[model samples]
Target chain A: MSHRDPLTPFLSVDAARVRRNVERVQAAADARGVALRPHVKTHKVPQLARLQVEAGEVGITVATLGEAETFVAAGLDDVLVAYPVLLDEAGLRRAAALAERARLVVGVDAVEGVRRAAPLAGRVAISIEVDSGHHRTGVAPGEAGAVAAAAADAGIEVAGVFTFPGHSYAPGAGPDAAAAELAALDAAADAARARGVEVPVRSGGSTPSLAASLAAPRVPDELRPGVYLFGDAQQWELGRTGPDDVALTCVASVVSTVGGRVVLDAGSKALGADRAAYATGFGRLLDHPDARIVQLSEHHAVVELGDAPLPRVGERLRVVPNHVCAAVNLADELWIDGEPVPVAARGRNA
Target chain B: MSHRDPLTPFLSVDAARVRRNVERVQAAADARGVALRPHVKTHKVPQLARLQVEAGEVGITVATLGEAETFVAAGLDDVLVAYPVLLDEAGLRRAAALAERARLVVGVDAVEGVRRAAPLAGRVAISIEVDSGHHRTGVAPGEAGAVAAAAADAGIEVAGVFTFPGHSYAPGAGPDAAAAELAALDAAADAARARGVEVPVRSGGSTPSLAASLAAPRVPDELRPGVYLFGDAQQWELGRTGPDDVALTCVASVVSTVGGRVVLDAGSKALGADRAAYATGFGRLLDHPDARIVQLSEHHAVVELGDAPLPRVGERLRVVPNHVCAAVNLADELWIDGEPVPVAARGRNA
Candidate 1:
């Protein structure tokens, strides 16, 4: 208690673990003869993206225009926004400016989305999104041709076709999701070719489905695996990553301990309350495997001491969030090797 | 598409509505013969807290040391941190420094918590917390005297007791939770008094149980109701707040609209993915009453078009988040009166 623990409940990233994770995934992508375009949405840091670039990554995928701007501002030359952006006039202007500085490709799920970005025709390219079992976004595989044709007509280059295998998040669902991704990408490319559009690039990947995506009958030309950078409780429970692969943890202080109840300062605000149906608790303690975080208020996490000794008040614990992306989104900075690194693109969800 | 909607997804707050809500709650507290010490956890803005002060609030309540530091740095004088802070030497030094500038009261539930803050015994006072059915934090009512005696022996002034009736959030549990809160406060105070401690200040509140906390057999000396400043969908659905009372909204654009499927740019990151067992959707559209958000990804929300007409791509809609606190915590600034006001205390979760 005399010595400070840098500030309780901050995000602590293991630099060595992150570097190993990057090398491991990059090597896998290289062996598959596919270009690794790591998604910066997982760790929104420019320095981490540089590590990916050094590992031979072709480009980076982002979820929002803000992320694209953040990386490009940090001197990255290529970015792919893998979400259909229905831009207003201001956004179009920002996209136009960003496209001038970097090679930018925006995802489009419908002809309407393609027409909306018509103003940035020559400056930016459009990638038609196809539904590959995720069903959260993207149009049907057969509908990709119409959107691709629409982008061509709007004077925007039909850069490629892509899909997000979101369903691969469940346990034992990766291989099937990867197969669906490949089949959808192939069908989408064929449809675009039928419409007199040249589909050269095929992009697909999610953390859980990355390995299977490469080993499928037809590997995609590019992959966008985000959560692989720092495995979370979901990936651990789903058997997507080994024990040593989780590179980040929320360092929290035990604020209250009475009988079986152990409370931590990292609550829903720190660890995030995005629980999977298969997850056993709200979050997992990295050091104590048996302890279960049963509940979360804004500033408190109630831990059920399962076979683990009850920690004294003021003791610190390393917590791995249910979803790392959600947890990182809440913090303003990251603590890497005891030094604070700004989450440069934090609160840039738009 | 031609006219810009500021930004696709951003937090928008109605200043007039927030003012009315402040006056309304302050009036209620006044009539109940209690000093309003509004919790700043909901809307972490000093200006809103200033509105409460102008409405006759005696002091302000916060949940964390970071929040207390934020409000105090913003020129707030009297601050009460309503959570037990297990401080290290650095935090103790900070608390001591803060106590010198402001009349600070920190909550203590365990004897260890009192000992940890004993360095600021003369400058800072300690408030004993009692468990009032929220089982989240606090000790039992009978245990208050032991903690109070420890604080009294540590040369710290005892600031009486407090309880948060979090169970009042359920549909019909307001009255019962309020009754439990009042009873716990009385019992905890009596126990402290028996230990030769002057138990003068009794604090109890939560937005849902504010009215019942006043009308119960006994009224608390102070009320610390948060979330009443900005009504959310949970408050609306639970019958705690009127439709017109909601002051904040997240303005989002329809990113994709194809046949029966419509997607908005506001996803779990913008609106947050905290869903109670009783909540119907991730959030509710203010303009469309029947639409339900079926799923939320990082930057995309899938909407089920229920009797409402499909909003075209680029169309903007005002959305009321399920929980206002979680939503506000995600944004960098608030668009109030068509101007940007920085959420200065954003990411002060430590």
Candidate 2:
């Protein structure tokens, strides 16, 4: 029933918790003797990516050319874009620009994608995407060697193979999906080795599959997990992390009470409309455990309470959004432990 | 299929179309002798609000204290917050400051809300909200008189009654819903008049209901319509508008082609994630009518095109987002007739 400040509905990141999670993930990779290339798609914060690098991460992963440019401008080298990029003329020019400053690695899963990225083939390294089980965008695992061979034929250096284990985020499917991802990567690596090409790195790991995938015998040389740095409702539900591990939270205020529903200042704009398939509500109210975000709009979230009284107007509370990645992408800056911290790469979504 | 601009994901609004829509609505209101208090919530731009005023609007309607403050700072003289506002200390102080320069009207739907506004009553005019079947906010029609009487007792002048026929947005529902809204407002106005309170203005109407409601029997003194200025997918689906009337559109480039799915550079951040229950897809592509936005992320919208074949990676397309209000809220500047116009009141989401 109290607000420390009136400016509610903003992004707040617990710096201590973020630092701890970053270090813990690095330690996990250290134990496995696999290099950690934490994905910047989660926080999109150059400061956090730098912390990971300082904590012994070998490199950082990005999803877009804009994101890679942002991190490279911030003086971070060794950036890999995990997404299967389809570069236009502008995108090709951007990739070459990034290659001038950092060790840029671009992902390609198709023959046409390689042709599109031909302009930067000599300048940047290319990685083949192996469709493990997600069936989203990557080429089949058996096709990886062919894709890699094609890229090599196009004058692009095929550095390694990578798969997303996107099914790992599915409910009760993390471990099995991680196992499948490792198996696919192993098959692709074997195929590449048979073709007299060295698959220097085989990367595959999501936050939910990080622990189990890293423990697998064939986890390759590097692991890429994004959301482990900022635990979300899905992470908590999947048992991949605990409440204390969550780094970012939406600081919102109770705005109005019409009938039984109490509306909050934060809505899809601040918290994001990313309700996990298995999540219970739109978000979790840390201040009121019994409160559930029933509905959300661009600027309003209606919270419903069960056997608990609603918070008064002007009362600020912390909300753990369903998906941390999307929520962080919407904000321009974040409060690091109640202290405003600039998110330098917030708007570089594309 | 060509975007000469470097920015891939952007929204463009035709200034001439906006002017036409503004003038059309103003003329419609003038013919009915109803004051046009256009809602600025849909497009939080002071310049656009000024356009409404210049087109002979009686005032401007807002949705939050932050918006009121923003418009007031930009020299808008009359503003009405259509939502039932909770006047907390900070909100009251802001309202007091805004009242110093502009005519401020705050909505109240409950006795408690009126009591909360008592401190700021001296500086604001209160309008009691009646539930006109929107069921989102406001009290029932029978309960409006008591709330209006309470506001009078608290020294807050009951300017009149207002309601939103939100149900009017549904197919085949606009006329009846608008009629119901007028009936509710009529009953509430009569009740307030019986209580010896001067009910000078009775307001109700959304975009779908505006045209019919203006012609309805016992039309209110003022009309507040937000989305008419920027026709979106919702308007098109409801048969209230045509594609040519869509002034705002998000321009994005085709980023990738995987099997039948084509990924675009724009996503929730640019097009917004607002979808109505009856909406077919996230948005409609202006050039590629066969493509549909199947899935959306923070930075990418997965568009699927069937047999028509997707556009090339470098090709650009314009997308009419499902909801224009939320999409407008996400941008800092809007492209008006292909020119980037600064949105003076953008990001005042509170």
Candidate 3:
């Protein structure tokens, strides 16, 4: 690949590093006898999805119908929208169209969600989302059976049970969050089976819980980890991945330096303003590990160089953002190696 | 405009309220005899820029060259990029091209920026950005004269002096920040005059300090307020504007309800993850004032309804985000009244 410096405040991905990450995760999942269905929400690039599929991913997972449509349009047939989608008329139409093109599996946490998705009964499979300590979007473990039954009664095919161990993102919370995810998925699956419904696919796993998933008493049949491919500062801080494992970074130029403080052109708009409670700073400068992003405006990241030399004007620095998914969503394209790849689902927030 | 409900998690603007906000701010600026140059970073729509110009704004202020280019291409001239630009090769080329289309004014905070931008000698005018306690980007008030002199020595025209009272975003800091902005601009202007340089324009003001600007000892010649046109939750919490004054809101659907907690389709990807330290919550539900967003994921905003009726599935709720500029950047289009208008400069963060 060419070594030309990319435009400042642009996203760049090391293709070799991404391939290695993909193979590493796939091998881990394979060793555990669990199918790896990488979440495309992290990169939102069809080419990366294709790479995952070629690397032995069973299918792909998405968070929005817009993302599912984008993946389906790119010829990725099997897709799961792991979100409790609000079935408005417009949403139903979009989901129905997507179901026509792929083996679309949608998540439902409430009976109303099932009733709303009844129109696409034959076309779409419904997966009951169980709360696994995240408490963001999902039903209680005991309520999953009723939701699954409701979907089945409405003539929809039951996909199975799924939960996101999102709490695993917190520092020192991965193992417990993974254990909770296993219990929740097992309880939901048992509840569905007791109601005479078949639980075909059980899915659970986040970047932080990927390894924890393998050690759980009841391992999930499939894992859907997104951010593991492009490690972030949060992942680095959590010890889930080392600095060398980070594949994607925002290449930014030092725009201004005054009062011993350096400012990069990358800001919330480039690195995203997602600061986990455990995150040390907004982002970490790859070249200068000692530097910390003290402040972020819409277009500037103020860096406090503790002991590292201050970056000169126009000098580019790679920054590993606090959250990779949010960072990727903000980018229009990814500079893979030296080639520009469109972030097809960049703003696909439906 | 049609009366159909838009897709969930989409940005919607009230045309009437935007017009009212424009007139309100315009009247305020006119009363103080200060030219209003609305910062387009808030809305990023050319149509809104035209509305501001039609409402008596002398010109428009932008935060990036991409934004300046967007406005200039839309036929609106006299653009001021209120940023201490790095002036890298690509940046200089872009600035030169924008200067050909409009009266381009760029900000410089150091001699390096002035030297890098000297290539645009006759085409671009440079404004020395003075630090008014923000400490984000800008030279000290006393140092602005040297930067202005350096720019003049390089054959670039000196436009004037400007500072952003960004510290005013905090609660109870408006009056003090406004006074500081005025003092900084005044000091910079005096320094420039003493250096035998003409300071033609003196610009300062943010949304929080718009009202305080009028009462400052030395009122600025121009006011550049961005978020005033679309009030947010931070503005509401800071008592700058009431809930009724908010012109923009994200229309989201109640996707799930479990364990007395309701979840909306709007998440960080929709509402933007910009919770100011002094802000109340991620966002405020306009229809249900008692409802507060407790947590946000990539695709779900968990709301804790306090004594308010829980919304059912498929119900749409308007959310006033904590920061309007960050929220607008995440959206691809704005549903104005009932029609969709593309956020022309949505990801123009070059």
Candidate 4:
């Protein structure tokens, strides 16, 4: 904490810890001969993306075109939107304009998505999304051929295939989810190649699946893990990262202590109300590990102090949020050991 | 819904519905002889606050000094920060500066809060918060006298007492919470009056407890309800508001329909991830009333269409979030009938 008022909730990132985490993931990917394209959606800051790139990341992955524009404006040229984009006419124009400044790659899961993206064929590259086991966004492995063929037929370059092993976020589901991810990527690549389209890039991996991704027999060409740089309580609960690995923490003050419960100034507005199924509480108090955020309002996090000594009003505490990506998105700036760094891509949801 | 890209998730507010809701609440408060002080934390826009004030609201309630500064700068004079403020030297200086421009009122639950606020005694008015079964922030009703005496002893004017019946958010808890709130406020006022302090402002109420508050025998002198302006999924589930009463919705387009699941571009980043314990889902799709958001990622909302036709890729839909306050806070601007209104106090979570 700096000399600033501790009563206000602010996000603090340990730059050294983030650098170490970046280097650790990069080293693991390097040993596997895979490109580590860290997702900037977690931090959403150009400086952190530059650090990851400097530490040996091939490129950066983003969730929205606005993020791509933000990073591109920050001078990071190579960017991949790892989301299936269904752009309107205006969006197509924006995407085309963004492509002029950077090597933009967009993801497609359906043929309609590819057809809608046809206007940016020569300017933008397309990656076919294959659903491994998350059952969220990607198409089936067998359907990847059709989507890639459609993109290729529309003069769009079929760059590669990508899948998110999001199910690995659950406790004890990492290995199976990673195996499924690798199998799906391989199947999609094989299908695309069978259709006479080259599948150069194979991207898959999340924070929990990083080790499994590195240990897989069929390794991906690149990994897209977002939350590794700033581990959250969800990752910690999933046994992917230890408490020390968490880089970002919300610094909040105990605003009220009534009925043996502590109310923190940081609520959903600061920590983000993201609770994974496997996560126990809204967030964990770093100083008092026994404290659990039992309830969250817009401006108050009601914490059950349990057997821990009651935190006095105005005492500052650090909280590890359940989801760092959501929490980081809520913050306007990140404090790096007292230095405030603006979250350049904070509200770039579009 | 405008010429802009439909695929980008954006918040849309129904101006007509907002106006109706404001008038409705104002009428109810007016009939009950209580001043309506709508919490600006819900819709942190100066324009909306102006509408609220124009609709018979006595003043506006904010959660932070930053928000007070924002509203004051916008020329809305009467502002009350409803949270227990613990200010440092810089914070005190900021408070004094803000008090110069507006009739600022700060809440205090502990003696330390009052003591810290004593430096700005003449400039800022202090309110003692009372715990009315929602053990989130306030001191006990019996202890209100000591807190008021301390604030008065420190040369701070004891304005009134306030309590947030936040527990009323749950189903079937509204009446009991409202009764507790009225009883606590009455007890606190009596205690303060016995301490020779005038407790004129008796502020309390949440969206769920609106009816209960109006029906209570010992009604509060003022009401401060935030979420009634924009009903959410949680409110609907709690039977507090009907679907038509919801004024705000997240307009998102279906980007992927894989494995029979519809994935919208709006995820936790747009609709917010605040899920109450009794809530059914992350959010409910307005078009498909039965559809529930099964999972949420940074930019993907996986919706499970239960017996409803699966939303096609590129199809636009409106989603009612589980918590509107959290959702609105995530957005940079709110689209009011195709007009973009900047959320002036979006991240003023100081």
State the DockQ of every prediction.
0.58, 0.38, 0.62, 0.64
For model 3, how does the per-residue alpha-carbon lDDT over A74-106 read when each residue is reduced to its tens digit? 999999999987776777888888878889999
Candidate 1 vs. true structure, TM-score: 0.97
Per-model C-alpha RMSD? 1.9, 3.0, 1.8, 2.0
lDDT of 1 by residue, A1-350 (tens): 32224688899999899888989888888888898899998889999899889888998999999999999999998999999876677778779989888999999898878878898888899898889887777989999989888887888898899999999888889999999998999999999999999898999999999878877767999999988889998888888876578899999998887545788999887877697878898988888777778988999999886888778888888998989999999998898877788898887877
Docking class of 1: medium
After TM-score superposition, the amount by which residue B260's alpha carbon in candidate 2 deviates from its true location, in angstroms, is: 3.1
TM-score each candidate.
0.97, 0.91, 0.97, 0.96
Q: What is the TM-score of chain A alone in each candidate?
A: 0.97, 0.94, 0.97, 0.96
RMSD of 4: 2.0
DockQ of 2: 0.38
Stretches of model 2 off by over 4 angstroms after superposition = A1-6, A190-196, A215-217, A237-239, B1-4
Candidate 4 TM-score on chain B: 0.97
Interface Cα RMSD per model, in Å?
A: 2.3, 3.7, 2.7, 2.6
lDDT of 2 by residue, A172-288 (tens): 787798889888998888877766667889888888988887777756678899998889877876778888787888888776666666777787767767665687788887656
| Residue range B1-350, candidate 2, lDDT tens digits | 23335376777888888999999888888888988888898888888899989999989998778888888988899999887776777678888888999999998878888888998867899888887886666778877778878888988888879988878878888889889988999889888877777789999888999878877776778889999998988788887878877889988877666565677878777777666768778888766666678777666687766666657766778888888887776676787776777666655556
At residue A323, candidate 2 shows an lDDT of 86
Model 2, residue B127: what's the lDDT?
89
